[model samples]
Target chain A: MNNMRVLAEEEETSDGVEVTWEDQQQINTFAKLNARLKGIEDKLEQLKQEKEALDDLSTELELTDEDQTVLYKLGESFLHLPQPDALVRLEIDQASVSSQLAKLGAVAEECERGMKDLKVRLYAKFGKAINLDE
Target chain B: MVEQKFPESLDKNPRGIPKAPFIANVEEYIGGPDGDVEGPLKDFQDAIAKYRYMDGSLTQRRKGLEDKIPDIRKTLQMVEFLKQRRDRKQKADDQEDDLEEDDENSEGAKKPLTTTFELNDTLFAEAQLDDTDTVYLWLGANVMLSYEIPEAITLLRSKLDAAETSLKTAIEDLEFVREQLTVMEVNTARMYNWDVKRRRERRSAEEAAKREKES
Candidate 1:
């Protein structure tokens, strides 16, 4: 057990630097940024999926006649409305979803930029000792 | 439900024995005029790497099982609650008809279960669950199916049992992997110490021979 502990410690400091307070702070910041980036990426992926589903629905709606009454899901119930009204509602939803996706994409880009800057600083200080990538 | 089967390799070793053989005498284990310790050290390193990889995957599997168990339990609870509420309403209705034909009393006895359900996000709306023999369950991929109360309960119960059994197996596999890791680490440490001792003895013996020639 004692030998195992020593071996584990060696692996941690294998980059050949004794961890100082400043270095530890930088490491923690990198971890926090990485986690935030991951969350944003997940949201971005989900929004993309939502956009694809909405597009498919729009294509199907275009094939239906304007005089037909279409069923639109609202909350827990369905609303039977004219095809024109349903198309308008779908258009409004698609617009909102697209705007949200754009905003998330911009934020994700900013996050990636920040991570890159941090990576450069960390690598400069620790050389090959610190691992910044997942 | 299908029976849960763990890997045969993990199940084969009931006794906790190190996969790598222990070096009783390090000198004899690496016996040679040159004392070639590199080959044995490389073998030990490979075994440790293999064990570490197994440990990593086992830990991930254990985590997945842990997350799924709670979801199964929650679903089971919901189904059981629905079944209980249906049974209670049925009993109340039968008693009201048998005892008296009072309209007001019958209305009170057949009162529906009122609750709030989420509309979207944080928004919710008040709703009442009327007397119904069937409930719909979302079977993923946009498909939903209606099943009677008794049938739903049985299905949920069976699913819960299977998830629980799988979780137990995952936990056992994780423990077995950890034990193997410890044994491999101890073997590596022993081999390393033996090599250092052998090198020191060789150096001191050479110095002694030089001193005798100077005298």
Candidate 2:
């Protein structure tokens, strides 16, 4: 017979319970395919979680223009203020806000690139498997 | 005689690193011929000292800064900023270290199911099937395959993890950007809405007409 099992739990007790090559191949192939399906499912879950986290981050980013406007106006008002104490404080505060916004803008661009890359990858890999959520 | 050895980073490949003679003519002349051969050993003493100081622990200094965060974290916003800042810093350091090791042998090694020849004990132990009797040409258990299967699974899990984190982080970043842009966009639309612009233009025209009426 061209069929055999290298070893099996059931066969430890029972003798000559031969497994065919065809059966072994079938089993191996099935195992591999099952593993592949599982991988896809896991990836899908990960992407979903990623989407959630992105949503949370976006909330932090929602106020750029208003933030800038408030900051710039404060700076302008500080220059006009006669009191040196208040003027210096407001000027420093304005500078800090501008710097923070600049940093935030940089981080925002990075996030956009990452999201775009993920979208492209998902489209390429899972276009057939899942629907892209708006 | 003390021989000069190469740095650890220089010894990656199979071939041995070439050792160079230490040139210390001034010390060599005073130490005699035999002592000249070993003259560089003193230089090594200096190397060791330099290494200790240059790459020595910043633990004390860093600890002081880290110590302050906990006290600051009593407030809500500060705590959130600290957590985010810490995570980013840790990841950045990990990336720098990974780059030194090159892409293949770094964190990428533990990545999803595709296997290469390197032996990793954790994956090996997890993947191995229980070996049954017989040392040679064993007819029963497929030990080789069972081992491969489990390791592959472990690798796959790591890969999936990386993919998941990246996707989530990206989305968070994009959402922030869009919302930020929209805030300005919303303000612009409010100030320049079609109805408002039209009304402003009409008001201007009416003011001019009133001036003509007055004349």
Candidate 3:
């Protein structure tokens, strides 16, 4: 009853299915949320691939202070850092970097929760998925 | 000319938000002296052109925002993934005390791992990897350096953090664009409805005058 009141203005076409102005607005919102969800999923997959690449690189070497000059990326440029110092800094920086991952994971989960909320609302309103493409 | 009043429903509600100025101007042009439709018709055309220009630019801006969201999302995801991988390894490393065991056995460990090293696209060399030998990392821009595994993981993590910050900003921008697009859609709909009502009134009045003259 409350939903019907909220969806107050209904228009009946030649064929008898009832639709409201509110429903149209909700449908548009649903479509936009769906698009955003897709973007989030794609980004997550790319992050995984980058991690795997780093794992492979780490498995291949035994670095020490006596080794050749090490190149570290700084913005768009690469600068030479002493192999020993680079190793020390990287080891120290790893803990903070790992924590950053945890924070990002939380953000990703929040995004998913928001999407689920929108999806439930959309399903309740339409009874079934509305095919805007058609 | 018969002074016929337009329907009350067609009149703009004074209590509500003012109707688009273009619609009111068109009414004045069509309803004005000599009842010349051309001046008002030109005004109508200019309004449509202006509306279309605004619509096109807004749509283009939305599309640009959409394209950028995915790219930024990818960078964010990459950082997250690297962090995850590092965390997992750190967990396993914490449970074990044999972090240097592999390297220690590399010298006396009887297994000479014969591996092919690809020096260049068409060049390869057979080399024996000792258990203690360090791994060489190919840092982009043709630079290579040997690093302990933990150091390498940390280095990658820093990159991930940088990427994540950029992605967060990009997503915020995308959300702002989405909000703007929704507002644009509502305004466009209201303007279109107003224009149609004005056209209908003009057509019906012309039809009524023609009928009266014929009789």
Candidate 4:
């Protein structure tokens, strides 16, 4: 029990929660992060017990109603957690590509303006509408 | 009806739960005989039963108090994180503006030209707050702290709506929990009182003193 207590990051909260979807998410996220950190939180102790649980089948062991719930929770936790390293690398590459595309767009606009300026300079000096299009 | 979302329903799983003993303990604790008592439960069923009236009163107060603390602490967390984010973002934004102004000049000694572009503060404020803030905050992003104030204001309006549901449900659940704790305290006090009463009646003053405890 002491080891479990040591593992959990004890929050010095004195009150129970005021239930809300937002609040529920906060609590669950806390739990999931705790799972990653192996936080010796009060709930994790409860979870550890479930992990090693026996015949009740209603918890984390096998397929029971509760087991269904825990697995789903684990899935949700994983889903919300940041993407895997490979996926994150891919995302970074995509972002770099997009930023370069934007830079290209800005360069294109600047070139268009520069071309217009050059066209006026040529017309001013040559004093003729040369068929630049040809 | 407002959506009733409990921890069990949080993750949408169609599979199963484990048969852990701790889970059973938690379940039993929440669903015990005197555990569900509400509204300052009678002293006889409480842990504070050693005290008949006045001491039982203190025990009840303590239980009622324990309920608001978590909410208060959470609210405090929301506030502190927001303040920190707001400061950091504001400083960074100010620095960026200065840097942009510097870029507009080739020579550092040249007088900075004032631009006619006036930024609308309201636009900036609105842009900071949106639905994604909550998820960001939940994911523990410190940057979302910058969105705290505006989100709080915007969330307040919707909260009035969601509050009707969340608060009602929260209040109901709070009341239920309060009752359970209150009864436990009171029962404890009452049992102490009964023991003391027996000792006093039997002229065993020392035993009475042993049983005499604060609720």
Q: What is the TM-score of each candidate against the true structure?
A: 0.52, 0.19, 0.38, 0.21
lDDT winner between 2 and 3, please give it.
3
Isolated chain A TM-score, each model: 0.83, 0.36, 0.54, 0.31
Off by over 4 Å in 3: A1-32, A35-43, A63-69, A76-83, A92-100, A132-134, B1-174, B186-215
lDDT of 4 at A103: 54
Candidate 3 to truth, TM: 0.38
Quality of model 4 by C-alpha lDDT: 0.35
Deviating ranges (above 4 Å) for candidate 1: A1-134, B1-11, B14-35, B102-109, B119-121, B139-143
Interface root mean square deviation for model 3, in Å? 13.4
Query: How does residue B101 of candidate 2 score in lDDT?
Result: 45
Q: In order, how many clashes per candidate? A: 0, 8, 8, 47
* Tens digits of lDDT, candidate 3, B1-215: 33223222232322321122312233343565335444444444444454455446545665665555455444334333334434544454554456644342232223333445446676856555443323455566999887654565556556556555555544544443443345335434433433554455666799999999999
Model 1 lDDT tens row, A15-122: 365445455556655665666578678878988998999999999999999877676654333445467757876886799789989998897888788788878888
Each model's DockQ score = 0.02, 0.01, 0.06, 0.01
What are the RMSD figures for all models against the true structure?
15.1, 40.6, 14.2, 32.8
Chain B TM-scores per candidate, in order, are 0.76, 0.26, 0.36, 0.27
Q: Give the alpha carbon lDDT tens digit for every residue of B1-215 in model 4.
A: 22212223432212221111112122133354333323222322332333234335544554554444434444434444344344545555566678864332122113221222214532311112211233233213545444445566455445345534553444333333333334344333333333333334545566667779532
Error of 1 at A52 (Å): 47
